[model samples]
Target: MREVEETLAHNLREVREKKGYTLKDVVKGTGYTEVSISRWETGTRIPKATVLYNLAKFYGVSVDRFFWR
Candidate 1:
């Protein structure tokens, strides 16, 4: 589970950076705080399914993108 979380964190950060979006930009679009986003990207916290869905939508990718390939 920890490995899965880490993979998700990496993927999330990668996708965000690839899209040229800052944490503040994600916060504005996803209604998630920068702290929360940071935590998620750092693997210190895991987002709920709905949150994941919302993030996927915001990034224009499938939720599976956050998982190991």
Candidate 2:
């Protein structure tokens, strides 16, 4: 993965883990499919802006958190 993608993937996974949530749990909370969240966590796909915002809000984190990690 590219550096930015890697950081985002890592941060997403880390935050989810820290919150004790599974991919399925995120799906329920965000109204996104588990497959899509898994792809983002694996750096296989980047979320669109709205999706990213939803995920950030779901995780109670700022969007910048994904980039910084």
Candidate 3:
């Protein structure tokens, strides 16, 4: 479970960066703070469903892609 969580975080960060979005951009788009994004990316915290939805919309990707391949 921990490994899967970490993988999700890593993939999320990779996708965000690949799209040229900064933490500030994510915050602006998803209304989540930079600290939260940092925590999520570092696997220190798990994002809530709403937040994940917002992130997926902001990145124009499916929420499942953040977890699954």
Give per-residue lDDT, candidate 2, residue 15.
Answer: 88
Tens digit per residue, CA lDDT, model 3, 1-69: 998889889988998999999999888887788999999998999988888888888999999889875
Clashing pairs in 2: none
Q: Output the lDDT of residue 19, model 1.
A: 97
The candidate, 1 or 2, that scores higher on lDDT is: 1
Poorest lDDT segment (10 consecutive residues) of candidate 2: 60-69
Q: Candidate 1 residues 1-69, lDDT tens each?
A: 788998999999999999999999999998899999999999999999999999999999999999955
lDDT of 1 at 37: 98
Worst 10 residues of 1 by lDDT: 60-69
Off by over 4 Å in 3: none
Order of all candidates by TM-score, from best down to worst?
1, 2, 3
Give model 2 RMSD, 1 decimal: 1.3
Using Cα atoms with residue i matched to residue i, what is each candidate's TM-score against the true structure?
0.95, 0.92, 0.91
TM-score of 3: 0.91
Count of clashes, each model: 0, 0, 0
The window of 10 residues in a row where model 3 has the poorest summed lDDT is 25-34
Computed on alpha carbons, the lDDT of every model, listed in order, comes to 0.94, 0.88, 0.89
